[model samples]
Target: MSIMSGFCQISPAGLCVYSNEQTSSITGYSSEEMLGMGWVKAIHPEDRHRVVAKWKKCNANRDTLGTSFRLLRKDGEVVWVIGQIAPFLAEDHRVLGYIATLSDVTGRKKAEKALQLSAERFSKAFNASPSMMAIYRLADDRFVDANNSLLEAAGYSRAEFVGRTVTDLPFWVEEKTRNSITGLLQGKEAVHNLEGRFLTKTGEVRIGLVSAEVIELNSEPCMFVAINDITEQKRAEAAIEVERRRLFTVLHNLPANIALVEQDYSVRFANNYFCESFGESSGKYCYEALYGRKTPCEACRIDKIFQERVSCKWEQVHNGRPYQLYGYPIHDIDGTPLALTMSIDISELKQLKEEMLRLDRLNLIGEMAAGIGHEIRNPMTTVRGFLQFLGAKKACAGYKDFFDLMIEELDRANAIITEYLSLAKNKNIELKEQNLNFIVKSLFPIIQADAMLADKYVALVLGDIPALPLDEKEIRQLILNLARNGLEAMVPGGTLTIRTYNDADKVVLEVQDKGQGIAPDALKKLGTPFFTTKDKGTGLGLAVCYSIATRHKAKIEVKTDSGGSIFVVQFQRKSPVAPQMN
Candidate 1:
């Protein structure tokens, strides 16, 4: 029926009699050569015997026969062909000649062989893949084929999976999952890494990542799926999350300010105390949040922590508060290096330590002074009486001036001994409750006169204060000494300020001077006996004041800067009444 076919007429003995134009084109032989010699001469040597046997059978039975074989062309090339022969019958029912039809089928044969090779390669790869693979018919949702991995993953045999639908097998943990997959396939949507739970034959539930695509198998639409197990990975992630939450809880309730900082000084995590002190510091530079500075602090120790891989500690003062900072290097699970810093407020602790040391020194000095004062007074009194008696003799008038000078020197020495006796351990004094404002009012006149003499101003900022149990004589001495010291530290036209107020549960008395501040070295030694900055003056003024404050159970705090200095004495609300020590 197609023009590609070739036709020829052959005798019963298999010689070519009549040939069409297509026969010459198909075999590369003209009718002149083929008709005389015979069409059997064109048969390939390899197929010649088989084709001749079929031809002889067709001739003997006069039945239609078809066969395929390779043909040798006029140019010695071999071609595959399909041929059919039928008997040409006469009126008497005897065969006249055979009618044969031939066609060139080489192109179709080559295409079929290529397809077979491709299918073999695909089968090998699918079975050898590590990931589970399956192919199911989309129409019936029945599994058509499954690889060894897929059978192993489900703990099933190949026979158990081949003809079964997903619903018939224990594959999906939920019925809704299968429905969702079907919906996606029907919509022609490819699924990628869709998570689903699966149940194996052993009743084990496993989490899997499934990917599916619609493909054609044997001219029928099918679904090809690949599954990867992710149960262990999911469990590991959950455990890490729990640990992270526990760490956060511990850091949140800690008393000190804690934070995690990166190499660029950026804060990665800040605990509750750190956030409360610095205010929402995450993603901000450490220096900017902690010190309100635009640049990093000059003494940052984060680099040292990284280099040494150990903890480092230092002290810093910020906004009139002291903090002890400790930093340690830490690496995250991903091995990224970071600094963990903890800052503790040590301002009050440090002040208390200094106060204790000062009190210990005062007590030690008082014991030594009391012992020496008594020994010097008796000898000084005898010398003063001898000098007076010598000045009174008329015969000694020429030496009277010398005797008077000697008496004056002896009196000066006796006065120093009396001052030292004030620091004795057993001196007796009475304690009485008195209003501090009344005492300040009484001292104002004397303090103002001294300030006026120096051409300085004195201000009395007295607030309402409670009555304090005090020895009025000792309290009076403490106030005057501090007030006169303030005046002396200032120049003419400078102001000396005295303030009294209640702070927390304590009563505060403050003395301020507007002048060049005390030298750093001198400030540390201010209350030490015989330590004075002024020449031609006794250094016992501040020492005696400190001793009075110690007897009253008060604390002396000093703050100095480039502008001036302030000395504050804090007394407890109720004083312990005991014998006052000199």
Candidate 2:
């Protein structure tokens, strides 16, 4: 019989008596060769003995036999087969030959072997992985298995972890996180990078990124989870953020304009002062936002920083105030070019430097004037008396006009000498308790007469001030010199204002002129002896004013702009001294 299965009849002695075509094809042997041959000979050696014993017993007992074994073919190949045999007995109940049917099952056996090999490989890889991994049975929500990484992370042994549910362990620090993960898994949706807090057995918390998916294990659905610990990374980020805030606070409060500009001329960052000065310029073009220009400024300082890729320092003027700017080429972590700029107001510093230079010049002149002033004045007074005597004599009446001009020149020379002597550091002065406002009020009439002669107006404003030690004559001279200078500097109809007030612990006298401001170059030389801006000026007028101010232990400060100028004299307040009783 040639059906789906091979058919063969065996003799009572377990020998093959007859075989069908399918039997010959399955065994790789012909029917003639199999006749009277022991069928046990075709069974593989590994199963031949067991199969022969079972076949003999089944034939003797007149019962059916069922078995599966590897059969050897004629070509030396082995095939897996399953067979069912039934005894065909005679009416006398004696022993009879057996009829057997065999079917090929090699394909099923090979598939089962491949599947076992794959499972073995997967188990080895899962246990050896470095990332924490675990499997939980879906039916009971219990851990079926956990890798070594997961055990070390959770502070548990495999024996203690297996068969334990999520509730039985202190794993997820928050219950909601655990519930969320469970819900996702139950819905058969994958959880990808679900960040959460995890707790170890020692109660230490750790940040982790968890991912999970449903997988089949042991013919049942289970959840496979992977966790990546990121506790250190998170802590480092927080520390960096705190440090950034501290640095920002320091820059914000600094008394300078600080900014970071990108290569595109856009403002990346600006400190509080810079923002207040420029009006919130973040993300805006530096030139347009800061300077209010439609185009980039010519010879821009920050531009040079990027072009040269170096640091630079320069002075610039903004809103009539001078600032010293420092710019540096900088790059970020990504290597993007930028410019870091800081601008500090240097207006007061420049003024102080100029003042020091002027003082140095004054000291040098004072030393020279003290040595020569008295010598020059003695000769000039003697010459002035001789000239006056000659002008009155009849013999020299014809030369009277010449003598009068000579005497007048001699007097002018003597006056200049007196002004020079006042510059001497050891010049004697009489200090008395006198009110500065009273002194200013007393001098206003003379000042007004001079302003009227120059076709200018004069105004006086006096505030309440306590009396202080002052040299009355020196104060009068100081007031006259400053007032005359102010009157000369203005045009017709220009007003001159004189003001006196108490400023802090000092007294302030301000002389203001409504005239074109002094030039910057000349401003630095204002109090230097022999430095003058007027054509008719002997240049000793302001020098004498400065000398008188120095003698009184006062400070002179000048403020000027395009509109006008103000000369301020600050006098230190002093206590009155007790008079000696005769």
Candidate 3:
């Protein structure tokens, strides 16, 4: 048999041959033709001696032995073979030729070679991958698998991370971190992309987003985690938090008051100023804080607020200080009412208001003086010329005395015109600090005469008022205007009630009238120019009342209905430019 069969058979001494299907498989030959071939011919020329020696070992022990040897196929291609040989025994147990079997093994060998090449490629890719990747043992959380990227990020060697559970050297984490990882493992939540801190080997901490998944490795569960450094995001978040705190400080430390309220009537939140304004009364109800009484205030402003759902303004005295309370209602995150309220100390504001009203009055007086001067000056001039002409005429003797008397009257009329001019340009007002008590007390005698004019149905009721700094002339004017308006408003007459009191900061004056009510539309215009509702009304009565109240830094409030109207003036003692001296 030729070795070209790739599995020729022969004995150790080259005796009769015996072979099997393995020889046909390797050489691609028919088994019947190969069964008689010498085994030596199956060996390649270079491997014949090695093959003979390996078979000799098998022959001596009469047992099968396996070995690798090269052979030639019938197509003359060299292929690898794994052959097993055993010595065949005679029926009487004498010596016999060697029996053997072979496998092509070439396909298997080539497959192994390809597998080795693929493994090398995968190892290279794993080392070069950008994402920090690691493999951990599922049972113990030991680092079993890792790419070079993970080593660079962790600043640790393969040995440093390998045996250590996340507990050991902690190349990328600490003990607490390890516990968190253990919890994740137990819960099997497969936590991912969680930014956390890690301590390096040199004790420097690094921030990273660690993403991981649990999987089975070599039949045991393990975690494959990928970590991405994101220290910048952490820094950004910290900066934003700092900025937020600064803004909050600006609002909370304001000089005035600021408060945060819910849509409900309850007080939900407040700032430092708010806390100071309300004192310990914060966290109570909004209405209850201002009034110590049981129910909400009768003059509560929220009723108007409910109609418009917008910012609202009101005046109230809190802790002896008058405040202009402004409330703004906004929407919270869930699109619900987030109410904010602020109280600005308006004691100075009162004085500003008074100054404005006084200026308005002077302006009106100037107009009236101009109009009156134009109307009366021409008439008086005619009277003066006629009187002069009459004196020169002897035939007009009877008219002389009449003309003379008219001229004298004209002089008096001209003098009155001059006074009206002064009233028109009325800037020079004497501001004297006077007593409200004395002023009201002085008006007691005239109350009877005013009532007599209104058929005596109107009664004047006086009460003691705080004697504070005021302009006595203006105070008197203020009372006369109120008394006069009350009588006029009630044709049938009504009671006139004037009362006064004082807190630590301000003096309060009230004038209530039980007469025809002032319409709501005409309320704001009361203190303004040309605002009145009466026949032959100059609209200057209440405007004058406004002027008097304003010179004293007072605010006028009018409440009216079918029943009557109450006009109240609140005066503050302190001012910005100069305090009023009584």
Q: Which residue pairs in model 1 clash with each other?
A: 423-582
lDDT of 1 by residue, 134-201 (tens): 99998888999999987998899999889999778888898777777778878889888889899988
Candidate 2: pairs in clash:
none
lDDT for model 1, please: 0.85
lDDT of each: 0.85, 0.86, 0.69
Off by over 4 Å in 2: 1-121, 167-170, 182-189, 260-270, 279-289, 293-314, 327-340, 371-382, 420-434, 466-474, 519-525, 546-555, 561-563, 572-582
Which lDDT tens digits does candidate 2 get at residues 284-338?
Answer: 9988876788877675787779888989998777778888989999874446798
What are the models' TM-scores? 0.63, 0.76, 0.56
Using lDDT as the measure, the top candidate is 2
RMSD of 2: 5.8
Off by over 4 Å in 1: 1-246, 275-280, 287-300, 315-323, 333-335, 345-357, 391-431, 561-563, 575-582
| lDDT-better candidate, 1 vs 2 | 2
Q: Compared to the true structure, candidate 2 yields what TM-score?
A: 0.76
Residues 366-407 of candidate 3 have per-residue lDDT tens digits of 678777777879877886997889776998887888878878
